[model samples]
Target: MISLNSITRNLDLHAQGNWLPIVVSLVLFLYALFMPKKELSWRDLYITFGIIGYFAWISDSVLGKMLDLVDFGNPKITGIGEFLSYSLIPSSLAVIFLNYLKKTNKWILTILFIIISTLIEWGMRKVGYMKVHGWSFFISIPLYFVVFSFLLPIHRKIIKCRD
Candidate 1:
């Protein structure tokens, strides 16, 4: 006997977790679209966007749902908040990373991106957007490193295929 009102009540739209995902996703999407693209072509942008978005989705699904290492919003249900946080932001991050990567030192920039990503995740956790289970926050440091590190290699492979 689950009512629609009960589901809606659980959303807590006024909470940061409910609204921030949509807002952050929109902002990041706009930024990715309008940001300077001196290092990437339209194809690169599009491909990277899809690849990283899919990667984020897959990784989150495996780690959060399958293995139960974390929870994005409520563990009982998946919603728009989880979608935006899991997909768009990471995709935008890939775009942004590739854009700056060409102009900076690779290892240094990768580390910086990892740190920034970890901090962002910490912020999201603080805002109630996520909950970690069966793992410590420190685990994300290396996880972010792996994700950011892969960005360059993947972009390069795509460009190689195109060229």
Candidate 2:
């Protein structure tokens, strides 16, 4: 049987080490660099980075520190795995998702992202990479909705201002 302690401690997700997420994150970042990008202005970049900041803050500083709700491989960025998996990986996805995704079906797309986020996080949790305390993956569905609420609008605003 898999217990929280076993997963968190033995799996080396938060303590020992994790390689899969770090490698995947690096690959995604490189992919992002080569992906087609529209004419984005400084404002667009700032907004996207802001969204990234919010993502890292909410999960790392707030939930991980203040609320003790989750752990991102490790409490701090002591190695490549922790830095890439916890910080860089999320920000990379945020920048791509926010900058690229269209708001054609606003609510539907939002819900879709929420579902995707939850499922991914659930997988990480199962693998002991992400540990949620006093919270279920279900709660992440709404959390994602909230994050995207700002991300999409800010992205739109930045694009609009540039135009």
Candidate 3:
């Protein structure tokens, strides 16, 4: 019989020291380098980098300290894994919102993003891909929502200005 704990442990073992994010980052960097720069301005790049850095700091320093979500076994190259984990969430959301939903009402998308992202975090916890050593899912969900809310306006402004 496969117990929940056993499943969680296996998932943790599988996820530990994964290199997928690094590879993806390399691909993204290369793609950005080669792509036409007509759409994004220096201000857009600055804002995007700032947002990513802010969220990464929050996730690693603030949230990690509060929730003890740090994966001690996860091998990081110059702390890139930690940064990428947090940055990817907001960056992906920004891309989706800017590319697809700018003209539509944003409230609905905001709610959906919060819900889906929270659920994804919860699922990771359940599967042991994420271990919340000091915090519960209930706490994480609201905290993430708050962060997302704070980031939404910045993302919108940057993307809109660039577009």
Please provide TM-scores, in order, for all candidate models, with all chains considered together: 0.83, 0.69, 0.56
Write the residue-wise lDDT of candidate 3 on 64-102 in tens digits: 665555553343322444445556654544444433344
TM-score of 2: 0.69
Candidate 1, poorest ten consecutive residues by summed lDDT: 7-16
TM-score of 1: 0.83
Q: Between prediction 1 and prediction 3, which has the larger lDDT?
A: 1
Candidate 2 RMSD to the correct structure = 7.1
Which pairs of residues have clashing backbones in candidate 3? none
Off-target runs (Cα >4 Å) in candidate 1 are 1-16
- Residue 98 deviation, candidate 1, in Å? 0.4
lDDT of each: 0.77, 0.63, 0.54
Runs in model 3 deviating more than 4 A are 1-46, 65-83, 101-104, 158-163
Backbone clashes in model 1, listed as residue pairs: none
Instruction: In angstroms, give how far residue 121 of model 3 lies from its true place.
Output: 1.2
